[model samples]
Target: MSDYLPSIYTKFLAQFPEVAEAQGAVAQAVRERTPFDERTDRLLKLAMAIGAQAQGAVKSNVRKALQAGAGLDEVRAVALGAITTCGFPTAIAALGWIEEVAEAP
Candidate 1:
């Protein structure tokens, strides 16, 4: 796991190992079903999170995107680009979520 991931997330995965394994398998299955490369897939997911105005998902996806080698600028662009379809408030809120992960140690 990336160092930027929140401790709560890691602890939850640890505390619920079986569920975490299941979720990991599901994530791998989804990745296998995708034609997009890892970086592209992660970026698209981040964009979707932004559009959905899901703060936690935004943070998670931002961390995943960066772990998959996306630049912070690319992540920010995805959130900001959501403004057109998702509106300013949603995108702005998502941007904050992205920053929370992107700027983390």
Candidate 2:
């Protein structure tokens, strides 16, 4: 229900309210079960999104990371560090995606 949620995702949630509720519950459960703090969790998700080469996920995680108090440098470091594990192209693309959210006013 966040205004910042992508329109497509909002529509999907609206169309499948029950599924959305279940998905939200699962996400909450995972967060509660995780040992990592919110900032670390978001940063790890950002790294995974970079590895998966998912632009939207990368951007979303970047925003979440920032909200969780991650510094800009920390976000950039995660993307840059992916170059060795995820390759240069994936890292570069993720950096761009990070910028899209990080630089937004």
Candidate 3:
């Protein structure tokens, strides 16, 4: 666990020990896949997390997206596609969350 794990995440980890293992597998798989792009599958899934109002997943994916070199513009474009696919409200809310994560250093 790097400094990237925010306090919010640490608080949750007290209850979900499995999160670490699951995250490791997901990270490895994601790293083995195509590079981050608005057209990529991971981008679509990130949008879905937003649509589902999954805060934990959204935070994790957004961090992963950034680590995978997804720029804010690329992410916003993905969110636009999400608006089309997952509907307006879900997409907008997710966009907000993604922006928060992407802006972080």
Candidate 4:
């Protein structure tokens, strides 16, 4: 696991060791199979999260995207681009989710 994982994720993994191991295995497989760089992967995941209207996932991926060297505009673009497919309201909600983390102190 990467040192960059959020504390909440660590706590959840600690609380559910079986799920943690499975998650680790799946993550490793995805990494091994994908050719995209970390930044692209993060952004792509963020877009998916946006489409799903998953608030926590949107925020989490935004943080990872920034850690992977994505700029604010790049992150914002992902949310904006989702507007077409996810609809205006869902995309707007995702933007709020993104901001919750991006603007954190």
Full-model lDDT for every candidate: 0.84, 0.90, 0.71, 0.86
TM-scores of all candidate predictions against the true structure: 0.84, 0.94, 0.64, 0.87
Comparing 1 and 4 by lDDT, which wins? 4
Best by lDDT: 2
**Model 4 lDDT per residue over 1-105, tens place:** 122556888899889999989988999999889999999999999999998888878888898899899998899999899888889998889888777786676
Model 3 alpha-carbon drift over 4 Å, by segment:
1-3, 11-19, 22-42
| Candidate 3 per-residue lDDT over residues 8-104, each given as its tens digit | 7677777777986798789678867756563355566677787787876776777766666666677777767877777898778877877777666
Best-to-worst lDDT order: 2, 4, 1, 3
Candidate 1 colliding pairs? none
Report the number of the highest-TM-score candidate: 2
Worst 10 residues of 1 by lDDT: 1-10
TM-score of 2: 0.94
Per-residue lDDT of 1-105 in model 2, one digit per residue for the tens? 122988888999989999999999999999999999999999999999999999888888998999889999999999999999989999999998888886677
Model 2 misplacement above 4 A: 1-3
